[model samples]
Target: MSAKITLIAMQVCGVLFISNSAFGQATPQDASVNQGTSASQDAELEVLTVEGRALSLYQGNGAVFATRTNSDIDKIPQTVQIITQELIEDQAAYEISDLFRSMSGVSYLNYGIVKMRGFEQESQVFYDGIKGDPFRTFTIPQLFNIEQVQTLKGPSGAAYGAGEAGGAINYVTKKPTFEQENTAELRLGNKGFFSGSIESSGPVNEDSSQRYRVGVYSSTEDSYRNNVEEDNLILDLGYAWDFSNDSTLTVQYTHFDQLGERLRGVPIDENGNFLTDISWNSNEPDDEQDFQSDIFQVNLEHSFNDWLSSNSTVRYYDTEEVIKFHQARALVDNDDDGVYDEITRRYQDQTRIYQGIDLASYLVADLGEHTVVAGADYHFASEDEVFYYANGVNNGVSNLSLTNPSYDSDISAYNATLNRDRLTELDQIGVYIQDQWQATAKLNVLAGARLDYFSEDYIDNEDNADNTSYNDLGYSVRLGATYDLNAQIKPYTSFSTGLTPQTASDQEDSLDGELFDPEEAQQFEVGVRSYLLDNILNLNAAIYHIDRKNTISADEDGNTSAIGKVRSQGFEVDALMDITPRWVASINYTYTDVEADDISEDNTVYRILANNPYHQVGVWTRYEFPAISSSIAFGAEYVGERTDRTTSYDAPFTIQPYTIYDLSWQTAVQDWKLQLNIKNLFDKEFALAGFNEVSGAIVGERRRIYLQASYDF
Candidate 1:
């Protein structure tokens, strides 16, 4: 650890201890005065009430990224889902995948890939409305410092340029608050897992114009599989200043460090069955993976007058990673004994750096019965990447038998043969504009458009030769309308377009040095939002159809072309209700149908898309007992069967469906709280993902338990 980080940790610990001791001895008069003053201040601020917080799990009133303004959810003509801090705490979530239980039509695949609406969302992740590279390190961002997560379905290309057709996910970080709050927590779980964290936030000045917040977290754990372990540390800090002109400036910084051993899946047998009998990891004990990152951002908001306001944001990100592991490459049957004989291993190394900036300004005006909003945005990004690979035989390691494996082989030969090296550089820029109008008392309209330009450069570092350079320009647009039938119900419809630029690697694979055109997609959607029983019950439903063109494919003659097309259609529904004053429940379901046309042969189509489930359902409920200040929650998730096709054998296979259950209990006493969570209640064995060629499969985690205790000052 660095000296600066060590000093900060010591200071935070000392402050937490001193604050707890001082707050424990308050007199009755002081306590009463403090309560009265806090209530008065809360009335002047837009604080979230207990009921409002509870209702956020099912529906949120407003979101900034959904419309680039503080517009009500019912007024937006798209499907959006918000996952709040309360839900994160109740589920004891540590990673992004754990929070997907509250959403429908989304799937978490291997290597942290999230799929939505039958499309992969590998490059469509955002933080505070700014884009971030999700595949940079192959690890999802930790959820310890996040306030909420929002998902906007369908194409948002008109607002954010250069992305996939699967939509986008934005993570909102915790900000400094005027009210004083501090907390300390400790967690213990199975497999020698232990974690601790401290959080503090409050005003730094008497006038409450300046505020500060800080959080520190550290954890260590051993995995269920052999030779796998992990350690991690994270630090976050924030400051906000409210100027005399009624404007605000906020700055934030975060650092993360993680080290662990990579886990490789077991190879499949000849009969296309997962090797469940394997009790040890395939990689050697010396294999390791390390990651480190630093992030900084600044945000400014100013109001020129009552009818016009402007906001801008800037961010910088730096990340470093190192990986060394033995990967399974191929399975061969050397002997005719009906069993796999040899397993080959490969080694790889990669490094990448990413930096980006986004600037946007907005104007709001009112003329007659119409409310008009206009905006313009500009974005720029640069990335550099390098990769190297080595085979097992050249590295001094020998292939092993399937039934009997040995780890005594040396890796010195492998380290000496790492000669291949490649480099790639990418740059992008975009501009956009949007407007929203209230046509009448019960009608609303929205329209937007964007233009983008991007370029890519590639080179072979070892050979000192340039490969290729590619560039392209693209445009997108969106239009929507909504009608309010009553105070509790609204119906809407929209049409949107999306575009994705091809990379240098994609172009290099084409025949005769011909570059492929960018992929394009269009979608049509209809939805309804309703609330009943005095805003205690919330319901939402949506149906959508998408058509994608110019997808790349390979022909039997070994030539690549952009003559592919795909169609996807789906329906989703969600409901959340406060059954009484003490009980809460939420339910979500989705049905998807996806098909692709034949690119290798004429007049042929696939029945299903790989790794995409046709049906999904999730349910969660919580009940509280005020007498004991305790609450218990129950949840269940179901994933339907999916299909995968093998190209070499021209055959199809199926992955069976499965369901998992979870339970949580929480209790509070005085200034302390305790919680217990159990996952995979039935200890069922299942596969999270697999390949149709019978190469390997990823096995889901087994039953585990976690217990945590926290104190508030």
Candidate 2:
């Protein structure tokens, strides 16, 4: 080991020893497994040196449940990416956003907006195939109880229900195991970061027919940006009972809480240069954003015979949120000299309450060389929202100097007006059937169809004249075929269609006082997968095209129409290789070209679509040293340049291209594992993307260092 690494390892050992003294306790498994003896040490080293490389974590060779089928990932014709739990641990990830950095065809924008395959996605994140949000806006899932994350590229409305046209993300949660196990972890880092978590799972009875698992995670952190701090708490509880050899039932509950300040981007010049320090704040310290949610789910599995089986799930979710902040309105050019001198800010207070219930069931039948899957699902939701603003226009806010920012504005005693008070209800039912056929020795065919019925009611609590009700029937279809050319290569092609229901808020945004039809999407994809060199390397590549129509659009006069259309085409390549017994690497690249058509001639929505990048790349590599029981990893990503604009006449600015690098080290001793991570190692000063005409660019985080220690027995 290098001298620098040696010193860091020594420091980590000291920290672990101190922590063990304060938190460690004797356990049944720990007492039986001794690591101090020479024989045990030799055995550990032999195991690591002989069989340490993990191809499953990097190659994604397992089955994917997001398809609601029994086919292996390699045999499926869709583009699916599986991020394993092992990778999460290696990276010491804290939240879902942390993992998105290495993902392909995915981008993160401000205000909880995530783009997948060049389209904006909301409420598309799922937990074990069940919907997680009614309209996700400000919060993201934590990583405490997640086992793996599966990202299905393109629209999945045929298997799943109503959603965005982009894609869907499914989080597989950890379940109760019969084997006894316990784990605890503590993390400390710069910028006032601290976190603690513990989990335990084992048999609940001597008969081993009952099992239980419980986990708790809490974290608090301060950001490099000014007036930004967040605290989070989560509890995961689960129980499983085996009724007989052919049947089992499981129940789970999760409670989540988060509190933080909602911030806007820092103002920038026309060239995308920061007008002030990246740490500058446009909100007050007293501003706060709070969110809480509760989820309960039950699942049952039964097997009538070797050829037939069934799985069912039911879930209920409720969430509440409150947000109060100073929102940027616009930039003012007092001199009209093509330079901005002042910025306007407004006060906003909003509250939301949402509840939903979902039920889904599917049966699988195996007949000779064919497997058939049939499923049905139902969903219902209700939401109430209220908004309070200082006024209805920019006059309610004051102006601040572009170079000098102040947060002394107080709205405690100011009289605010109710801008909106509304309630919305949604009901949906869908049924789908899919069949996978082994047509011949080398060809496999898959086909599916779905029919969905949706109903929606929007009520204006403050204005009875604005109430509206609507319902519709939608259909989706999928067809695919895969050909096995040889033992190491397979080629596939697929076609699919999808539809999304327009939210009540979106419908209300129309200036013509008329609702539009639901949006529709169609996609065509072709890909190939290969395994070479005795399964030491894996490569996959794909090209796809998608078209979506009936999008909402507004003209310069504020008149709206459902005549907008979008065209998205992309190419992606991913590879994983084992260079040596102790070395592994993964590389991925994405090229996306998205355009808009049939929009209002005088609108800027087409220009705003340029915010999505055209090219992206990610790489990760790791190497292990058996003698020291340590491993090191390096990661990097590049995002292509994009355009930032808010209106048709606004002068657009260019967001420069940038790259960020990360490093991590992990070592194990006895029953303890320690990890140290350096994010943004070079402290690159850059912006993610622009929010609006005047809100400036969202600055990226500076360099950060954190260490995590975990104990498992």
Candidate 3:
């Protein structure tokens, strides 16, 4: 059934493109009507002004401001997806993961940074044009006070350093506008859930020269299935001081603390077949565990002069997790009387810190019509990972030896076991130059490259002799060109490069010389972005061919093995349409063509486990009623089924495409404001996991509702 749907989807998409192409030739006859329809649709956000400025907050509400506008989005050469704040509010999505229901070609690999993508790790994430956090952290975002989110496809390495080809995701935080902003919400639903938040930001002075913003959120809940609950809290504080001059200083800090259940993959039998009614018990009965992850960061940017500028940041992360499952599932009998054996227990804790300085200067040199930039950056990060495992009758694999199925108010009974500590440090220094020059009024040439030197070291506390260090040098390059086929449409092409390390494991004998060469991943991209219907609507489409090789895999002998490579090529189309005074819509689609260059084992390798799907799509739209001062938005997402070619056992695992319908209403009653949001309107059961890996399993969210009211002085 899934296969049938996949084929039909592919055919329809092809037909739509061909049919649209044909319509292109009949433009003269439909030109008048097209202009009218386009205008009517565009009226939705064009006339709308935020306190009287021709700005679009909802159109790209969730996108990075610098890259969300029609002028910039249409001028760029890549595909992008925008999830506006309004849309977020409408969905009442409390976390970034909730967005999977309305996104395409992207899925959480393991509820973390291991998301499936056409790019490698080390990809960058941004919040208001500044780095957010390390990609490996897989930090989930809080939505009580976000403005916009932008997902840019292809390598953004040109603007962001130490990036992977997976493109980038930039989140724009809610800013303290010149005018007052106010909102409040409370959510209560099934599974003993309760959540609440309040936020306000505006001018501290009558002149609107100084502003302040604060947001706080907290949630407590027990989930569907056994031993699952969520306890999370978030805080955001910000201030902006705009001096009389053209200088501004904005200070913001975000802190989040969460204690939630660890993710669990679906269970499989001895034959490698998934269990029929796998325990709805989200709890790992054998593992009776809990997790806590906390993060905090500060950002500062001072525009001293137009010719020179500096940006700096400080960040810290701490995580603690405990696992109590038995490594061996089979039972054993020490005596002749057959008896069962229990699983052991394990726990892990980690702390990481990062401090960095990035300073860039835009040179005012007479180099024709060229925008030249030169800069240097230095950063250092250190991490300590601690692990422990225990064995005792009190800590067995089964419920008998572990906590009972029922809830436990206190968690003081467990004891610590074998303990191990590992420390790792990374230091990097880089310099780069970039130039964006217009060859002609109709064409632009862009070029940029960076040379980065990185050092890494690992130390084991007990075994001093096992400690090791390594270093490597890698260069990232980007080249592209854009042609203006008039101001309404432009076509562009680009090529970018990135580095993937040869190995992720600790180097033993040769940590310095032999294990330090950085492998390369390359990408070729071509796209056309356009502004049609009077520059109010946006249409972007692109095609890309990406390849990765020289990846280090493990051999049967557990030695370094540079085996096969992976490849994916696809075409995509994304659009944002402002059709009416109160209606807007967006869509993203990708059809990837993938193949393996080689594999350790032909049959077992390059299998369905590759997870490079053939097709993916997303669509979201919203409509607001200005008369009633209320608005509504709905979104849809689809992901094709996957096959496990290796086992041929659930060879065809069908994860039916699920749709989540959401609606939000916002209006003002004098000083009072009200909002209502609904998520997973259909209450569908599904998974957003990316592949056949053990981590590719999740119990999707169910129907949820939220409501709130607020008043300001």
- Candidates' C-alpha lDDT: 0.73, 0.78, 0.55
lDDT of 1 by residue, 1-713 (tens): 24434544564576576674633321112110111111232246543333422474445567878778777777788888888777888888887878776878786565566668877777778888887542354676788888888988888888787787878888998898777777778788998777778887778888879988899888777777656777778899999999866689999998888777656555554333565444445667677778788888888888777777777777777777767777677776788776666677776665555555666556655454444556655555555555556766766556755566676656666654445456566666777777777887678898888888888777666665447789999998989988888757889999998898887777877887777999898889999987777667778899999887787777777678887887888999888888877788888998888877745542123222666788989888888887998999998889888654333435455566779999999998987789999988897766565553434555666777899988777
Tell me the spans in candidate 1 whose CA falls farther than 4 Å from its real position: 1-16, 21-58, 134-137, 269-272, 333-335, 359-383, 400-405, 415-420, 463-466, 512-514, 533-536, 601-608, 644-652, 691-695
Ten consecutive residues with minimal summed lDDT in candidate 1?
A: 29-38
Estimate TM-scores for all models.
0.89, 0.90, 0.77
Looking at candidate 2, the ten consecutive residues that score lowest on lDDT are 30-39
Evaluate residue 213 in candidate 2 and report its C-alpha lDDT on the 0 to 100 scale. 89
Q: Where does candidate 2 stray beyond 4 Å?
A: 1-54, 333-341, 391-398, 504-515, 555-559, 601-608, 645-651
lDDT of 2 at 54: 44
lDDT of 2 by residue, 425-526 (tens): 999999999888989877888888899999999999999878878788898888888888875798989998889987666777776667778889888999
Clashes of 2: 0
lDDT of 3 at 276: 26
